[model samples]
Target: MKPYLMIALCCGLYAGLVAAVEPITVAWRDKAPYHYRENGIEQGFLLRRAKHIFALAEVPAVFVERPSKRIWRDFERGKSSYCSIGWYRLAERERIAQFSVPFHVDPPHMLLVSPGARATVQAHKGVATLLQDGRISVGVVDGVSYGPALDRLIAGSANQVERVTVAPASLMQMVAANRMDYMFADEADWEYLRRHEEGLDAIVEQRFADMPAGLERYIVCSKDVPAQVMTRINRAIGALSDAAPGD
Candidate 1:
């Protein structure tokens, strides 16, 4: 065979191999300091880490913004090659999807108490006592988890719970407006809201002595995701250092 013809054939084969690799769809929601769009570009610590992990694994990925409910729905529908970052590993979720090794550790959660409910909230000694009190109402975001321990506590609590589908910042605003007595907020989330959102001055940040330890977040994907792909992702996560700030 001619040398020029051999080179052309090799080039064509390489192109075919590259074209055969399908990019995974990485779904994310709008959560500042974690995952959000700024200036029409994706930005956040978790998002950056995810991108790095995928790159290190040599996996092709395409990020798309979607609502949290929709992300979970895609998994429920058995969507292939779909993944989402920074989700808790829960039993029900495990039944529906696969999870990677934990990639991020959040700080302990704090309570955001409404100004009007300050006196009432202060009366309780800890999270347990506070949740058991039916007098104080709590607002929770729908389809969100506060880790297994806290989630169980919230479920078993006698407190009046109001579930809403809103961003954490908007939930803080609801607290300021006295929509509910208090709600759980991630330490990092509170920091971001405190610095950026207005009308939060009246909102009181309270810490309980019995609050559960911070939960680890993982890259959750549809069950159809290849085990080999997950293995690569997990290996990449293991190789990365946890020294990144705000993680």
Candidate 2:
């Protein structure tokens, strides 16, 4: 090859390498305290932490706001680069997306029952029982993953339960009106709801079981995302643990 041709080839290779570096597009679910938008700016605890990770990973970042289910679907389909900041590990999800070690820990999700149906909320009974009685309905986002037990319950008798898949605020609205009998949501989410939404006073919160393993939130990546990227994210989150607030 000619000397000029050799230089040209080297430059092309360098350009290709740079082009291969991926910028992560994070999905933001408008869950208050964890993630929320204000004054046209996306901001929240997990989201801020995710921004820190992106900086450490040396990647550019963009936030995509969507319903929880849509976000997961987009991430799985590679329509987006990154999933939301927190989600539980799921075996089936592992087949589609890679997840980082706990970037942010979330409190266990508790079962919320309408005050009128408090008698129907059993600590150990199958959720199906309440649904079958026609006195209760469960609220969940259409595609949001809730571990095996809830999955089985929904699959086996989901039709019996009045199901509504909408934004976080909507679920609380359903609960307040007694239209939704049961809702499995993180404790913090409900706390946020109580403060913002009126009539949430009629709802009762109860802890049923430790959330299924897959439902525990973590930072999930697209299947094609490199493992090195995940490692960088883990390190960044670790650093955050030691980092002072707002650092």
Per-candidate local distance difference test: 0.90, 0.71
Please give each candidate's TM-score: 0.88, 0.77
Task: Identify the candidate with maximal lDDT.
Answer: 1
Residue 231 shift from truth in candidate 2, angstroms: 2.0
- Estimate, for each residue in 1-247, the C-alpha lDDT of model 1 and write its tens digit: 9999999999999998875488999999888889988899888989999999999988899989998889988898899889999898899899889999999888889999999999999988999999999888999998788999998999999999999988889989999999999999998788877998999999998998899999999999888888988999999898885444433
Error of 1 at 20 (Å): 6.0
RMSD of 1: 3.6
Q: Candidate 2: lDDT of 103? A: 69
Candidate 1: what lDDT? 0.90
lDDT of 2 by residue, 1-247 (tens): 9999999999999998876675667787777878888788887777877777788767677767777778777866776456567777777878877888776555556778777668766733644454455445677777666666667766665334555657767877787788767787777777877897787787887764445433456888787667767777778877877777653
